[model samples]
Target: MKSTVLTRRGALKCSLAWAGAAVWTHRAPRALGFTNANARPRVAAIGTGSRWCQRATGIDGPHGSAPSFVPFGDYVAVCDVDADRLGLAVDVVQEWTGKAPDAYGDYRRVIDRNDVDVVQISTPDHWHAKIAIEAMLAGKDVYCEKPMTLTIDEGRLMCEVCRKTGRVVQIGTQQRSDESFLTALAIIRDGRIGTIKKATCAIGGGPTSPVIPQVAAPKNLDWNQWLGPAPDAGYRYLAGDNGETQSWSRCHYEFRWWYEYSGGKLTDWGAHHVDIATWAMEKGATGPTLIEPLAVKHPVPFSAGFPTDDTQYNTATEFLIKATFADGMELEIRHDGDNGILFEGTEGRLFVNRGKVAGAAVDDLANRPLPDGALRAVYKGKEPTDHFRNFFDAVVDRSEPISDVHSHHRALTTCHLAGIAARLGRTIRWSPTAEKIVDDPQAQSFVSRAPRNGFETEV
Candidate 1:
C-alpha cells in the first residue's frame, strides 16, 4: 500500500480546515434515503468484542437510547478475532438493519472493502493505533477506543497517519462529550479554580501477581489470533480446573493488569480521569514535562518464590506518579486517593467523581451564576448527553468531535509516560515539543516496542 507523506505545513493547513469546517457542518455521509444516498458513508465495526458491541448498540440501537434517528448508513461489516463475539455483533446488526452483513476474523479484510467508509475500532490497547492507522491508509475514517495508543510513538504515528490520509479520526474518550466534565472544564477555564496549582487523579491499582493455574484456551476462542501483533505467549484462562473462578489478575478484560497488553489501572482509568485533567488544564494537545513514580510498597513478599515480578501484571499495584506540565501546573496520579480528581488552586479545591462534584467551599462556586451563555456554550448548544451521539454527529458532519484524537493523545501520553516511569522505576524528564525523553537513553527506548513479524505498524 502506498502511503502519503504530509509536510508539517500541509498538516497544519488540514487541521485548520477541519477546525473551521467541523464545528457547524455535519460531516458524515448522507443517510440511506437522502438524495445522495449512494455517497452515504458505510461503517464497519472492527474488534466486535464486549466493549465495541456496547458502543454499536448505543449508536444504532433503539431511539432515545441512541442519538436521534439520523438515518445513518448501514453496518456493512463486523470484525473480530473471537468468532463468538463477532457472531453476536452480526446478529445485532442483522436484527437492527434487517440485513445480514459480512463478517471477518481479520480487520484487514474489513479495511480492504471499498464499501466500508468508516471503521470503528474497539480492539485491545495495543491494537488501537495499528488498526486505526491501517483503516485510514485504506481510505476509511476511524473511530477508535480510548487510550488512543499504547505508547507515545504510536500516538505520534496515529496523528501522522490521520494527517497523511486526510481521514477523520475520533477517539472514544467519552467524558469530553459529557456535560458534567464540560461544565467543570468551563469553570476551570473561567478561573473558578483560580490559577490551578495542583491536581490529583486516583485509580485503584492492579492485582499483585499473575493468575495461577493458567488453564487451556476456551474452545470458542482463537487465542493466537486474539494475541495478534503481541508476542506469542502461553495461553492461560483465569478460570481454573474446578470451574471455580480464578484470580481476576490477568487475561482478556483482566489483560489490563498485564504490562504486555495494557498499562494496568493507569491507562484503564487514567484514560478517562487523566483526559479530564489535561482538558481542564487546557493541555489536550501537549504532554507532561516530567514523570516520576513514587516507589511503591508492595504487600506481597518479594522473596515468596511466586511470580510476583513476572511480566504478567507488572503494573504498579501502589504508587504515586507526578506529572509536571509546562505551565507549572502539576498532576499527581496515584493508586490511592479519593478515587477521582482533586483540583486545588489558590482560592480553594474541588473534588469530582462520577456521581458528584464538591469542593472545600464548592457550593459557593456551584451556586454562583456562571456568566451568561456560559453553561449553554459549554454544552455546545447540545444537551449534556450521550458520548456515542457526539461521535455519530461528527461522522455525519465531518467535524472534529469533542473527544478527537488530539485531546485523546494528550491523555494517552500521560498514561504512557506513567507506565514508562513505573516500568523503569525512575524519574524521567520529557521534551514534549521534541516528543522525546531528555538525557535518558533507556527511558527513550520504552516509547515504542518491537512488533511481531508481519505485524509491523506502517505509519
Candidate 2:
C-alpha cells in the first residue's frame, strides 16, 4: 500500500483550520505514511444497510440522516451482510463518484485491505465496537455511529485499542459539532448559569412492533452473519415493498427497541443528550458514582437484566433513572419531557435540544457574550468545523477530534449504567475509577456479555 502524501494544494485548502499548528513538514506526510495530500482519504464503508444508504444517499432513515463520509473521503468499497443493500450502495456510490467501488459481503475483508485509510462503521449497535476495534487494529481511522458500544466493557476495550493503535477515531456524537450545542456549552462553561446542580435528559421510549409470523430469511440477507455476536433469532420484517410482513422484534432502526441489539432509548437518544449534558458539565472522562432506578416501567417483564419475553420489543419503554456523580450532581434521565437536556444550576436553568437553546444563560450570550475563545475552547482550540472535517483534520494533524473516543466512552457508560439499573429495578453502586458496578454482583454482570467464540470483541 502506497502512503498518500499531503499535497501542497490540499494543505492550502485546509490551512485555515491549521493556521497556528504545524500540520505538515518537508517529510512529515511521507513519515506519517499518508498518501498524496491532493488525494482524499480512501474510505471503505462497512454495513451498507438502510442506515448506510441514508448516510451515503442523504436519504432519511432514522433520526433524520445526513450524508456521511461522502463529503470528506473517497468511497473505495462498501461491505454489508445484505447483498441487496450492498449492491444498492455500490450503485449509489458509483453514480455519485462516476466510478464503481469494490463491494464485499464480509467486513473483515474490507478492514484487511492496506489501501483503505478509513472505515465507517454504521452497523447495528451490537456490532459497532467490534468493527471499530478491528479497524483500529488494522491501522485504519474510524467514524463510528453513536451509541458506540453495546456494553460497558466494549467501550473500555475500544478506548484501550484506540490508545494502543494511536488511530484518529471519532464517535458520531454529532451534537458536539452543532453550533447550538456549542453555544449551550459555552454559556454553561462561562458560568452564566452558576454552579450546576442537576442535569435532566428526557430521552423518549422505544416503540413496540406489531407481531408478524415467522418467515424465511430474505435471499439477499445473511441472517447468520447479521446476528453476529447477538443471540440467534428468526428472520423478521416490518413490511415489504409489496406490503408483505414478517415477525421480528428487532431489525433496522427498530433495533434500538431491543435489549439484545441496543439499550432502547436509554442508548439511542441517550447517547446524544447524555453526551451533550456530560460535556457541558465537564464529566466526559468520568461517570456517575451511583445509579439509582428511581422509577422504571418496562414494556416486558425483566428478570434481572434479561427480558422474559421475546415476542415484542423487550427494552424499557418508559422509566426514570437517576445517577449521582462524584460532585453530588444528580442526572435525571427519563422517558418524559422533550428530547433534550435541561441544565439546572444554582442561579438559572437552560434547555437545549436539536431545535433551540433556551433560558437566561443562552439569552445572556447575546447581551454579555462568552469570553473570547469560549467556543473554540470546548472545540479543543480549533474553530468549529464540520464533524467529518474535524476527523479528517485530526487524521492529518494527529490531534483529537471534538468527539474523541474517551469522552464518548464516559458518557456512554452513564447510559449503560442507567439501562442496567433500570432493568434490575435496583440502585447500583459504581466506582468510576474502577469502571465497574460496585458490590452488587448482579449489576456488575451487565457490564459485559460473553460474545460468541469468533465474534468476541477483545482488546
Candidate 3:
C-alpha cells in the first residue's frame, strides 16, 4: 500500500476497483431490484452481542443485531465466540434476508473470505483493534463499535491501517448521526453559544460486584477466544434470579466493568458523551493537555495503575475526571449529574444528550432557524442518517463517514487518559501533538499494552 494520505477521490477509485471484482451473488436478493444492487457490499458481522442494539432504542430489538444493514449490503457471514449469540444473529439475518448465512466461531475465517468486502464489528473493546486491523489488511472496509480500541496504541495502529488500506471505515459513535446532537452542534458552531468555555459530560459510573466465584466457561462460549488481547483470567459468574442475571466474569457484558478489557464507564459511556463534548468544543482533532482525577473511587486497591483484585468488578464506582484542552477549555467526565453534556460558552450555555437539546441558544433557534445549511455543515455536507446507513453510504461512495477513526481516537484518548489518572490516583500531563504522556513514564505506560501471544495488533 502507498504511504500517502487516502484522499476521498483515491478512496472512490479503490471502491470502484473493488466493485469491478467478481460480480456479487446474493442468494436471496432481498434488495436486488433496488439501488446499487449490482455492487452492494458483502457484509460480515464479527460480533453478535446486543449492546450495540441496547445502546440505543429502535435500531434492533433485544438479542438481535445487524438488521439495519440489510438494505445496503448482504450478510455473507456472521461470527461470534458465543455460539448462542452467533445462532441468534444467524437467525436474525436469515429472517431478514431470507437466507441463512454461514456462521463462524473465529473472526479470522470471516476476514479470510474474499467475498466479504465490509466488516461490522460489535465485539468487546479488546478485540476491536485486532479484528479491524485484520479486516482492513484483507482489503475490507470496517464499521466497528466504539471506544474502537482497547488501548491508545491500538487506536494509532487502526488509523495507520485505515490510511494504508484506503478503505471506508466508520466508528459506531451514532451520536454523530443523531438529530439531537447534530442540532446542538449546529447551534453551537453557528455562534449562538458563542466561544465555548467549558463542557462537561456526566456519564454514569460502573457497578461494584461481590467476589464472583470462578466458574467453568459456558459450554457454548469460548472464553479464551473472547478474552483475545486481554490477559488470561478466570471466568467468574453469579447466576441471576428470574432472568436478571449478573456476571462478574471477565467476559460478555461484564467485561466493561473490568479494567483488564475495558476502561469501564469512562470508555463505555464516555465514548459516546465525551465524543459529543469534544465535537461540540470543536476539539475533535486533538486530545487534552492535562487530565486530572478530581476524585475517584474504585472497588479494589490499585498499585502501579493495575487493579489488585480480579474476583470482583475493578473499575471506579464513582469518579470525576477533568481534562483540560490546549485552549484552557475544560471537559469534565463525572459519575454524577444528568447523563448528558453541558456546554458553557462566553455568550450562552447549552445542554444536549440523546434525548433533547436545551438552552437560550436553542430557544433562539425557534425564531431564527439555523442558517440553511447549518446542520448539513455539521454533518459534513450530508443529511444525518442512521449511523449504520451512514457507514453504508460511505462504503458505496468510497468516502469517510461522519465518525471517522481519527477524531474518535482524539476523543477516546481523553477517556483513556482519564482512566489512567484515576487508576494512578494522580494528575497526568499529556502532549496531544506527540500523543504521549509527558514527564511520567509510569503513567505513559498506560497508553499501550502488550498483547497476549497470537492476539498482537500491528500495521
lDDT of each: 0.69, 0.79, 0.81
The CA lDDT at 275 in model 1 is: 88
Q: Please write out the lDDT profile of model 1 over residues 114-162, one tens digit for every residue.
A: 6677788877888888888767766677778777888888888888766
Worst 10 residues of 3 by lDDT: 22-31
Off by over 4 Å in 3: 1-37, 52-65, 241-246
**Residue 180 shift from truth in candidate 3, angstroms:** 0.7
Clashing residue pairs, backbone N/CA/C < 3 A, model 2: 3-34, 3-35, 4-34, 4-35, 4-36, 5-35, 5-36, 5-37, 6-37, 7-37
lDDT of 2 at 404: 91
lDDT of 2 by residue, 17-45 (tens): 23223322321342232344455678898
TM-score for candidate 2: 0.89
Q: Which segments of candidate 2 are over 4 A away from where they belong?
A: 1-38, 55-68, 238-249
Candidate 3 — what's its lDDT? 0.81
Q: Output the number of the lDDT-best candidate.
A: 3
Model 3: per-residue Cα lDDT at residue 193: 79
Ten-residue stretch with the least lDDT total in model 2: 1-10
